[model samples]
Target: MKKTLMILLATILVMLTGCGTENKSGGLEISKDVAFGEKDYEKIVSPANELGFKLLKEVEADENNNIFISPTSLFMALAMVYNGAEGETKEEIAQVLHSEGIDPEELNKANASMMSVLNKEADDIQLNIANSIWLNDKFTFQKDFAGSNKDYFNAEIAEIDIADSKSPEQINNWVKEATNDKIEKIVDSPLDANLVAVLINAIYFKGSWTNEFDKNETEDRPFQLLDGSFKDVPLMAMKEKFSYLENEKFQAITLPYGDGEMSMKVFLPKENSSLEEFKTLLTHENWTAWQKEFEVEKGTILLPKFQLEFEASLKGALKSLGMKSAFDENANFTKMINEDDQVSITNVKQKTFIDVGEKGTEAAAVTGIEMGITSAPINEPFRMEVNRPFFFTITDEETDTILFMGSISNPVQAK
Candidate 1:
């Protein structure tokens, strides 16, 4: 694990981190067909938690999240499309996504996308032609923002000239009226929209702990930081066995979200107990090893109650992750938006918010494929031992997108 220190405001803090792909030779499969299967969604969700952990470290100096996605929505949208898509279109869509650096073999190995991937992390989500038309057009919704083409004020909608009697104001107003506020502008100016289309994904999760953490035992415990310091932070502790695993690199614990459908897993390194050392060991193989060892058993746990937030521009990140062609204006999105002609994704933007307090966790996220696309404090007694560095993430068992990614070493500073 490599380490970097970023100085924000007046405080300097150390940061450590981690990506994803296939399951060959230890790599997790990332293909749409096989992506949902093989627990690829779990694979993706795991790293996201690592990202959250990293952000928690950085935010110890500031109060801004740095990653984004709506896990539940992303999963639901993927589920809808998975069940909705059939025959050639389904296979074609799968291939396109797989070609963008995912494993095609896994996709081919599975039959129904819903059967295998629903409740699993999905790499790509799709909607049927009917659903897209109904939600994006026929349905009435508020528009986000609008203005004349000449004045150029609306950030999302620009260049629509109001010269034809309507003026920018009316033109903008129409957009505001059409989207029902789900979309703010027609054209994200500077960026042009050749044609109009909509892409929506939804995810829902209900997971319960194999063993619930006892609120009665929650208490503030000292959280160790990378700088060799400790702060008294509340940790939610419960004495019950869970699916626990330990390897030469780190100690691991798996806590199911609500139903058995979703879960949150944490990984902490041993010996050096540093983020860098643990990150170097966070690989598909290591993940596979941990998964193989996971067993439904009894155990004790002490987790921190903290909230986290993150927002990021994912265009560059997606491009770097291998979907370069999709970013091209000439790329193929016919299957995605259900158009005869290909539509390109001009911009992608995303935002996420999470809160994990004493009364369970509440999270909300929005990803605009501009595209586009928590915390806690404890005062009560009962020990919530979230000391040392740990990982956290939000995931949908359906689509394989890691909606939000982060970590926390010092929960007190994790704004």
Candidate 2:
């Protein structure tokens, strides 16, 4: 009886934890606990960060608001959606996502492994990533598509009655909870009639500066804007030994958070050059080079304390990244559902919030990919798919993007 009870208890524990499960779907058996260490993390940095840099330029191409984005959140959400993508749609997404040369199974495991490693949170800082898929209760989606994301991304799958007036709130509430109320809502009050599924990824982070600034030392300082104008802002002050870099175009520094496990890199464009000009120089090669240029030096840093909440539709940006097919009404998402039902991404939007203050920094982001009913073209498999000095980013590696996938925030563009 005792032995039987122990076995029963163990089974119950597995059920509750949602871990150590065998993930087999679409002819691939994925390992739940895939290995992703510093070296593995480094190998994928170029591809992972390449998209974020390009997307940032595209997002800011329209207007210069205090820009902030979570490449990880956006990538994870799209990666889930990619499972159902096929044909040209899949290839475009793969190119834009920098997933070339990586097979489907490997992509799933890499995302899963990276997220798992990041979630091994420490006591001093908090970083959380949540993914989910909400299917229209009336819609029929591919079981394998749903299962792949569930197994690899650890997504919470649900069926929502779109007719229900409270359904939008239900989805928003998850965003609220996932972001610790930092983000209150993601979906609109009246859900779209064409909407079939919404794939979402939310990230919340709060961390204290390793070399914290003195609250009392904060003073009003003149800060430069991208337009060459100056505004008086409350600037936080800290003097200490830190990694500092100097280039002809910009000067940069690193601000570690939570025992140096992660950090925010800050860059300031040289007086002769403007933030606008420096932004144009943000190539993948430059990012890699900039990461290595930082040498430890004793310096006093003055940083402005600001907050920004920005939201925008990423349809344009995604399309700009050569992912136009997925957004088309005739997009081939056959792997996600029957071709007759037809589904494609009608909208890809993101909402991000950040507050940098004396005690610490708090930020949240939510990316929602809205799918609508369509007649998809049939084919093979599933599909899916930066800073300013005057920039700040928190990533696992300057090259590899670890901090919940790479995060870029440049509130310094304060108008």
Candidate 3:
């Protein structure tokens, strides 16, 4: 009788311990511990840089038009879906993400770490990143995939009736809240019935310049367009010592924000050089070299007061980047649901907003990865004026991670 009692006690203890290890809701287990370190950051930066440039190149192919994109937000959304991919589908995504050697588990940990780091706040600076997964209430998801996202991305998982009219509104409301209302809506139309899941990532950033431009100095100035035409724009002018660099092709300057935690780096191509021609020179090696060339200098600077909003469907771009399988019928997303369900990515979309003025910069971006279908700155002390088309990047100073990138060809027509 004593031996039997001891065996029963041991079994009970084991069951209780297992229960504590996994957090569960609606019959799904969620992971609670996910972390990463410096090595993971090193892995993340390479892929981010590659994707940023590639997207820029594609968006600029139209030429003579303003373009903006948030590669970081897009990456976060897709990385969540990547957790549910398998076989060649997985391999293709890994390759496009520049995460070839890293496993999905490690990728999640890295993204978790990155989000934590980027979202850290400082006086007068606000950075927020939020993620969510919305699932069709009638459909069941693989436990591991949902749990991994919850554990690593800190994503909110919601089971909603997709057939209901309020479903898209709920998702869009979450996105609006996450981005501080800069992006009001991501899902412009109703979702399809075949859609099984929608994964979203939204980011909001508001920072004051370390040295705010004086509103008194603002004046209407001529902004040259790519077509050799010029239009008057509200230009913010100042003279201050700033981080500056220049070479044969372009002159670049860094405008620090919020105690130097983040910055806008602008690259203005030399006269007679087209912005498109200069873009082709944006390689990791060249970017590193340019950073090395920055030195403190005092000169006059003139930049436009501009606001912009941009939206795009990224299916074709991702396909061109070697992630074709995820959208095809044969795509293997077995890890997300029952194998017989036959789900593939249907669409991927992003929306972004930015405002730059004398006080500082406020920017927001939202990226939605719908697996349902299975699918800048400038300076001048030595007198640098942003009178024409130029490229810019908003980045974290500590990690050198780029959050937003774009080109302004005509400031008068910025939006």
Candidate 4:
């Protein structure tokens, strides 16, 4: 079996605004035709949560920096790639994804089912997911690999001249359109002539708060940073009933969005506990325990009106999470193409944007795994104030899948 050089790009945009509806622009659309058994649903959700925390830990190594990530976007792109992997390369990817025991075919079915569920339209919210494959016209890809993606992921197939100057634009345009123009470009530079194919996934989510925050209540307030310095930022205030929890270490609250189909959960560490310390306790076990701890309560909530944009190379993070062979020369991706060409990943990059204000939250993220590759809210009433750094996650309540998550150390800084 020969290694396949692969480059994957994934983007996610979550927009929180006032009640309104917008039509999505152009992209390849997939029909809801895939199905999965009950076991498949279990296979999908468990590993997704595990990967969520694992990736979170890797990215949060920088204690003082603000961090945001879309594990779903990254997983979907790689899951498509996993369909084309065999042997040790496949094993490594599986371990990293925490899908070690599950059969790859079964995993694909689970993902397809999950995607269908997530793409279901609701009147109050818009969650759109689009996928595509751009292949170099010169190379002949395996039919089975291509067909699986189309059938399972609803990925559109296109043949492009990789050497042409317009190639990157074609791929980035798909990204821009899928992300509602929030992310204009995923490829900042031209592709290498030797590059064969680029697999891309984009998810866009826009929804209004179940109870929109009153813009009139927003006021400039002092936000304490991790370093003891403070910056004056617009703090959006509200007094509403919410699912709330408080323990010795932190206080948490869940704010619903779009008829309670989705929510933002916020975790504010106690003044005595450092954010870093709280993060150590954020495992899957702890998260489930915390969820079980929530209760209905009424209290005042004060959150900052902040916006952030972040970009980073994720090669180190994925490698640290046991996806090492895919990046090394010894890697093998024989299932990608029938030819004997050896392929290894070259780079992986991610970019994300987020804005939180009186209306809601808007966030976007793009992950480019070149085989190059590889790849919240919260609330609180009970007088909870997000005056200091905290952790938050925006999730699909029905499926319990986390869409976007981050930690805010300073609202004014946008790195």
Best by lDDT: 4
What TM-score, over all chains together, does every model reach? 0.49, 0.77, 0.78, 0.83
**Ranking of candidates on lDDT, top first:** 4, 3, 2, 1
| lDDT of predicted model 1 | 0.39
Best by TM-score, which number? 4
Scored by CA lDDT, what does every candidate get?
0.39, 0.66, 0.69, 0.75
Candidate 2: where are CA atoms >4 Å away?
1-43, 61-65, 375-415
lDDT of 1 by residue, 1-415 (tens): 2111110000001000001121111111223322234443453344333433333332222242123344333322222232223344344333323322233223223322332354233222111110111122312212311111001111122222322334333433433333222223333332222123233222222223445567788898998876678899889987665788876777788865434444667777786566666756655456656688977677777889876666655456545434455445335433333323333344444455555544344444444543110012355668767768888888876997688878977667544
Residue-by-residue lDDT tens digits, candidate 3, 39-109 = 56566876888787887777533233877788776676677778878998999888878888678889987
- Report the lDDT tens digits of candidate 4 across residue range 148-196: 7887777888998877889899988887677667777766457776567
Q: List candidate 1 segments past 4 Å from native.
A: 1-112, 115-195, 257-261, 295-299, 329-342, 357-360, 371-415
Model 2: weakest 10-residue lDDT segment is 5-14
lDDT of 4: 0.75
Preferred candidate (TM-score higher): 1 or 4: 4
Q: Please, what are the lDDT tens digits per residue for candidate 2 over residues 1-415? A: 1110000000000000111112111122223554334334344457768878888888853264467777766776676767888888888878888886566666776776666556534555655556667777766667777777777766677888877889889988876666555556767878766556666655445567776778899999998776768899999998899999998999899988878877778889888887768878888898988888789999998889987777777889989888998877547778876446556676777667666766667666666676666433466687642234333345766477645533345444666
